[model samples]
Target: MSGPRIDPSLYRERDRIPIRRAILSVSDKTGLVELGQALAAAGVELVSTGSTAALLQEAGVPVTEVASVTGFPESLDGRVKTLHPAVHGGLLADLRLEDHERQLDDLGIRAFELAVVNLYPFAETRASGAPAAEVIEQIDIGGPAMVRAAAKNHANVAVVVSPDGYDGIRRALAEGGTTLEQRRALAAAAFGHTASYDRQVADWLAKETGERDRVLRVEATLAAPLRYGENSHQQASLYTFAEGRGIAQAEQLAGKEMSYNNYVDADAAVRAAYDFERPAVAIIKHANPCGVAVASAKTVDPIASAHIRAHECDPVSAFGGVIAANRTVTLRMAEQVADVFTEVLVAPDFESDALAVLSRKKNLRILRLPADYRREGWEFRQISGGVLLQTADSFDAERGSAQHDSSGWRLVSGEEVDDATRADLEFAWRACRAVKSNAILLADGGASVGVGMGQVNRVDSCHLAVSRAGKRARGSVAASDAFFPFSDGLQVLLDAGVRAVVQPGGSVRDEEVIDAAKRAGVPMYFTGERHFYH
Candidate 1:
């Protein structure tokens, strides 16, 4: 009987020739020495370029230089080394193609069965705050070329682009060489590697050139798949952009898969946590701050303050809310948090004991994010047909005084404001920025007593806010999203015993409103700018 007929397309001739040819060129030479040693032990010929060849040779692994393979020396500061046809032809040619085989034979070029290339550290170089000249110099030209070539011909060539893939490639080569499936997977990884590297370069260039009309390259990694979106039937996934800091990158130390609502509330809590300078905790629900408090550094019990404030605001709303803190969570903190039925807890760090205690509640999501989270650069919002982009609202804490300046236009009449009352007015002004449109905030001292947000009418919001404050509304300062149109709203607040008020001074009846405050003896200051949050 004749020998079994073998299909030509089934495998490359090199599958019969054995794994002996390997090309390695990388800007990151991590694990290159060990990888080269493994290939050498397998009797593979190592072809390399520049510092890679030097490193391999230094490690006693024989390496044939790219200059030897191309018959042309590297020039123009190593930029012209691997761009030659000899290097690319070896990588891109299909061993299965008759024409490709013929061309290689006629050119006296040896096909490279394996290509290992990693691009220059463009992201790292740019991150160092170096000059543009230094950054431009580090951009890789030939490395990507070799990688693309190998990846394009993945049917016959194996491409490895990451140090993490070194051991896998080594193991495969050691075990009868890489299979076609392995080659295809490596090829996909190689393309992804090059694409991300190019994106970094593109984004940097765009920033340098101020090209807003240019295509926006948003590269993000999926953090998790949400259980559901706004509704149970809706599907959702969380993708974190590269620039975001805070809970976007937080690692889940424990808990069930986060839902869409959980992520939204967590973000609100984290933002509030970042806003406060001292050790603080914020409990957020339905994308609104429910309760927030500053902790004494000596005691540093954010959990207690958060719980008490939550109950004060509305204990029912606090249930299943997200909690965030700017400091490490302790056993005491965890115990207090456990008392409330919270959906998630986010902190900078958590003690081992705290983690153990919190672990008992298996369904609660816990996240540990990096501290010092702050918004940077631009803010983007998606509308029905287009994206709206703007610089993030200014968080310039130093730009304004915490003390109210009576020299400014006063909308309220007859109110003699003391220093303490003035401080509360300033506090209420800052609090207003975080509330929704037509919002009103009532605060006594540094803590928020009542918050009315997302109301259609300004006066109604003031009434609701004052009602929420209850007895605390008395002697507290009130802030309006816009100037009071009529003295009726001022009369309502004064009836509630609100001692001071702050609002934007753009109303036509500003004089009437100032007289109302003056008549009510409630000190009122008007900031020139309106802070209306839609």
Candidate 2:
């Protein structure tokens, strides 16, 4: 007899056999007792295994054990229980074939018309960080075998993989018995469930055994469907990785539906907020940091500075931008943010008064993230017919040495730096690390005043930075994401009255640039690190 083909259309045909026999097995056991009782009330025979059989028997439900059907006791620590031909043959045999019916009769094998099976708690076991032996023991073999058999024969056997499907199964059995279309859907779910389970096992083993060649396992769920793509007419949806902390998991307290651009800019802004230790805010536009500021509690309100400085950087560009706050949103902060027309606002939390004020504008999206939330793992991007994955930009300046630190770093030629000048230099260094490629940033007393991003030439970016700062560029510290190729860029910044500068200091003409700063009466620091975002 040929194996049963799992086809939904076959089950939906007018002439179809109703499911009369079912095999039930699960690791979770949730709702199993009630489901068994319902099946019994429907006059369906129940065949279970191991603990499941014992549980059903204790509950006064009739159940046939796999060993009883196979006429062999479960051996090899229950690993060899359901692998017998008597079990799989019954599920795989085509019920509509006369020769298959004769073969089953000769072997005295009863066909299993339905199967409800779930694998062991592999994810839960690995998450517990248990002993290696214990984790290995939890790796199930017989469960997957039975599930695959049932799913592969879904045309004749209904396959159920989740407890959530119990109600649907019960309803079908109560009304007109299981239909072929329902069985086919259950078969698809069964395959997906087993695939996910196997992937988890592979990932866990790779981590435990340190296998370098194993494929990385990734799982994600849909966050929401966006209204459109980059434009209004395109199609798009948001999906977030399931393994770690991410912005997709943030709680939406009171807000409108988030758009495609909102998610893009919001991710950029939140990453910038994590770069600072003090009270800070980052305003992002088109996936780039347009304005970022760090203000002392007494000197200036960080939230107010964020709105003002971001707008000042590029008033035309700040329109419809995404705003993010590392701290909770206060009433004062809400008022300042409300002044500007923004697409979304994300913060750790929002005060009642702040929410009340912001609610007046119904279209603005407000997201409340937990205070201690931190990003995890790497990010994945899809290209044309391929995928690109890399570690996320999860860098914390306070925790370790900046990536640019190197032995080549030295004060080639600059004015003798004072204590205050060095402090400003470090502040400028941190600010520069947050900017994009060919980046130039100007800050005074740790507050970012001007920024230039995505310029092809470093000198052009320097000019743009100074131009944006205008009068504010004077007496401010300047930082470049990369080492200046020539001394001309330093001259432009010095001519603008930039008091100090910080950079990676790797250019071959480093001596010339340092000499230029020293000649211009400016103090410079070489952090031996460069941060260039593309």
Off by over 4 Å in 1: 1-19, 179-182, 296-307, 397-419, 481-491, 530-534
Pairs that clash in candidate 2: 11-180, 404-528, 404-529
Cα TM-score of candidate 1: 0.87
RMSD of each candidate relative to the true structure: 5.4, 4.1
What is the RMSD, in Å, between candidate 1 and the native fold over all Cα?
Answer: 5.4
Q: Model 1, range 348-380, lDDT digits (tens) per residue? A: 899999999898898999999866566656667
- Compose the digit string of candidate 2's lDDT tens values, residues 320-402: 88888887778888998788788888888888999998888787889887655777656677789877777655345443655
Q: Which residue runs of candidate 2 sit more than 4 Å off their true CA positions?
A: 1-19, 29-41, 49-81, 207-209, 214-219, 299-316, 370-372, 383-385, 397-428
